[model samples]
Target: MKDTLLDLQDIQKSYDATPVLAGVSVTLSAGETLALTGESGSGKSTLLHLAGGLDQPDAGRVLLHGQDIGQMDDTARAEARRLHIGLIFQQFNLVPSLTVGSNIALQARLAGRHDAAFCTTLGHRLGLSDLTTRYPEQLSGGQQQRVAIARALAPKPALILADEPTGNLDEDTGDAVLSLLLDLVSETGAGLLMVTHSPRLAGRLSRRIHLSRGALAAA
Candidate 1:
């Protein structure tokens, strides 16, 4: 049987009395890629935040590898995020002061799992080896996003949460970057939960769920 990597059970969230996610539930397994899609106000990003331990659900449980992350203390939650989860954002949040190599190795180093050889391999695979010493400002949008992907995969985390990872690029660049992200995720055998507005992009994943009316529906 496939190992369950993340489980969201009846998740509920609110922002200052406005409900965002209402009793939404989902599960992702190891090496699986799941696309999350919805309208602008449908709570897709809220669900992703909850899943990544960046925010807590007002009700229900978030289990990572069968452990209830919601029950963990703040420090524990941060540790859990660092050690078991990798996040890629639409903005490509690479550190401006760090070189490509440092940016890629940052999370792994924080998680105490830095592997020099593996990081080198990732750089080569991402077509970033030649640019490792370059800063984020020196690269184009596509190259920057590639660095973000390399950083996320460096830790070999159990799950990867990507929110509109290709949103900043042109269509062709976005497609190519998305394909590379998927291939790298598959190579690492980590579960992927991606939020995207494009159905074309969503269709590339193994499975997809749509959020609407603050709840989940089949895509």
Candidate 2:
């Protein structure tokens, strides 16, 4: 059996008494790819945030590699995220002052796992090798999204949390990028939890789940 990389037990979250996720429980094993499908405000991103240790759940446990991240201190949680989780946000979230290569190396450097050769390979595969000296603003939406993917994968993290990773790209580009992402994840035996509204995209993952009104349902 594969080792469980992420486990969310009865996760509950609220903002100003407005519940975002209620009694949500999910498990992701190593080498699995799970797609999260939901309407707007269905709490998909919120759940990903909790799983990545970016936010604390109001109730229940958020465990990564069997360790309860919710019980960790702020610094510890941050360290956990830096070391084990790679996040690809819809907004690209690149540092404006940094070049593409620098931004891609940020997370790996923070985790003390920087691998120049691996990063170079990722850059080449992502079609970003030539753009390393360019800044985020200089690239198109698709290029920026590719940069985000490269950055997230540079660390070879055990888990990847992607929020609409290809939302800004054209269909062909999105599909190509997702294929590359899946191939890399499989190669590294990492678990993936991706949020996407497209059924076509969701079908590509090994498992699929839907969220509505802050609860989970079978896809």
Candidate 3:
């Protein structure tokens, strides 16, 4: 049997006295592409944060490869994230000082898994080959986003968590990025859980999961 890459059970979170997510349960296996959608403040991002070990659940279990990550200390959790999870954010959080090429290979290098051939090929596929010499500020929003995607994927993690990764791009650019991302996930056999507001994009995924008032429903 294939091992589950990520699992969240009865996840609950609150900001002060107000609740954001309640009783959320989700699971992702290898090579599966799952899209998450909901209206504003629907707890989609909260769920991603929890799943990625970026935030602890107020109540629930977070497991990565059958191990309870919520039980780990902050440093151990960070190590787990470094080794097994690739995170993508809506902001296109590339380092401003690094060239596109450096940004793409940086995390993998930190994880002691940098492969120049892989990063170079990813640059080619994401259409950032020419932009590799440029800095993040030198590229347009779409190009910057491609750099972010390359950076997230270079390490080849078991789980890829993207939080509105295409939110900054226009329709055409977003389509291109989504295609590259889907193809990469397929090629790498990594489980993808992407958070997005666009139904069109979500429809492109293999499965769609919606969050409402802290719970998830198949849509």
Candidate 4:
């Protein structure tokens, strides 16, 4: 059996008495892809944040590779997160002053896992090879999103958490970006848990789960 890369057990979270997640449990194994789907107000993003160690659960454990990072100290948790999880977001948060190549290599360099050959391969695969010298302001929305994906993967993390990664792109562009992400993730055997509003996009993953009112509605 493949090793479980993420395990969220009975996860519960709240914001000023507003419960965002209630007894949520899920797992993502290495080389698997899981899509999270829900309405706008649902807790899909909250769950993703917890999984990525950006937030702690109120009443349960968030484990990465069987270690409960929520129990660690702040610095330890951050380091564990940096070493184990790669995050992609809707904003494509590339540094404004950095060129495409530097943006793609940023995360890997921080994690002390920079690999020039791998980064080059990722840039080529994501169609950013020729755009490496350009700054973020010079690229289109789809190109910026591709840069985000390459940055996240450069560290070779065991788990990937993507929150509306292609949300800013048009339908066709979103589909193409998602395909590239899935293809590279599959090739690297990294577990992917992505939040997506489009059912069509969610259906492409190996597994799907739906959240409603802070709890899982379907799995």
Candidate 5:
């Protein structure tokens, strides 16, 4: 294992006192690709939410690199997600009003880290070069997902979190997209913690762990 980039120590989350996660913990290493597998409602999403700094754990701590994410306020957490973490979701969630190009560049512009060359390279690699001027509504499901992925990768984040990134696509399209995503992730050497239900997809990762009834165990 490499140096730990993200760490969850005794993480616990509850919704209306229904425990979603109980004593969940893991140390995500740099350049590692970890697959999180589980049935529905197994607290996989909750773990991702907490690890990505998208939500707070009711109890315990989250560390990004060496900084305690649980220690940061909302504003700091948002910044953490922006500058250091890349997140992909089941839904593409592109801004309907913005062009694909603009959506891809949005984060970089806000962080004042816009590198035109890098963005262009990402777009080309993601098969979005021709679709750059088009809006999300104009693209197909696969294209939209690709755009979302490009947006996430544009920032060159240290860590990436993907929640069923290929769930909405057909098998072929999903494979292609996943291929692009893994290739890009490998190139950047960013640690990846992906939530997936597909055994085929999970098999490609460096490590595999399954969640059952809110508990994670290596498979």
Candidate 6:
């Protein structure tokens, strides 16, 4: 059997008196792509954050590669996330001062996994090769998102967590970017857990889960 890249067991989280996720359990196997779809305020991003070790659940366990993230201290969790997980956000969280190439290589360099040739090739694949010398501000929304994708995949992480990564782009651009992302993820054999509101996009993945009122259901 293939090893599970990510597992969330009976997760519960709340902000003050308001609940976000409740009894949410999910699992992703190696190289599988899972799409999480739900309406806004459905706790989709909350689940992704806990799975990536960026946030802790009030109750339950988050495991990555059979290791319990909830058992690790803050520093340990940070290290685990940095070394094993790739994150993509709708905001295109790139360093404004860094050129496109530097931004693409940032996470890989931090993980001590930077490969200049691989990053260069990724830039080309994402259609950002010509923009390598420019800063994030100089690129269009789609270009910036491509750089973000390059940064996330450059490290060759075992799991990729994305929160509406293409939400900021137009329909056409978002579709193109999604295609490139899926192709590259397959090439790298990484497990992808993505949150999106688009049913069309969700159907593109291998499996789909829906979150409703802090509970998970099969889509």
Candidate 5 global TM-score:
0.94
In model 3, pairs of residues that clash are 22-214
lDDT of 6 by residue, 1-219 (tens): 777889999999999989999899999998899999988899998999899898889999999999999879999999998899999987788999999999999999999999999999888877788999999899888789889988998999989999998887788878887887788678877899999989999989999999998998656
lDDT of 5 by residue, 71-167 (tens): 7899999999988988998778789999999999987777678988999998987778999899999998888888888888888888989999888
For model 2, name the residue pairs that clash: none
Give Cα distance to truth, residue 34, candidate 2, Å: 0.1
- Among residues 3 or more apart in sequence or in different chains, the pairs in candidate 5 whose N, CA or C atoms overlap within 3 Å are none
lDDT over C-alpha atoms for residue 206 of model 3 = 90
In TM-score terms, which candidate is top? 2
Q: Residue 89 deviation, candidate 1, in Å?
A: 1.0
lDDT tens per residue, model 1, 1-219: 889999999999999999998999999999999999999999998899889888889999999999999888899999999999999876788899999999999999999999999999889876789999999999998899879988988999989999998886788867877777787668878899999999999999999999997998866
Model 6 TM-score, all chains together = 0.95
Candidate 3 wrong stretches, greater than 4 Å: none
**Which has the better TM-score: candidate 3, or candidate 4?**
3
Q: Comparing candidate 4 with candidate 5, which one achieves the higher TM-score?
A: 5
TM for candidate 3 is 0.94
Task: Give lDDT tens digits, candidate 3, residues 1-219.
Answer: 656888898888999989999898898988889999988889999899888888888788999999888778899899999998899987787888999999999989988899999999989988888888899878888788878888999999889999988887788878988897788778888899999999999999998999877777655
Better of 1 and 5 by lDDT: 1
Model 1 has an lDDT value of 0.90
lDDT of 4 by residue, 1-219 (tens): 999889999999999999999999999999999999999879999999889888888989988989998778889888987898899987788999999999999999999999999999889877899999999999998899889989998999989999998887778767877887788777889899999988889999999999999999964
**TM-score of every model versus the real structure:** 0.92, 0.97, 0.94, 0.94, 0.94, 0.95
After superposing candidate 6 on the true structure, give the runs of residues whose Cα lies further than 4 Å from its correct spot: none
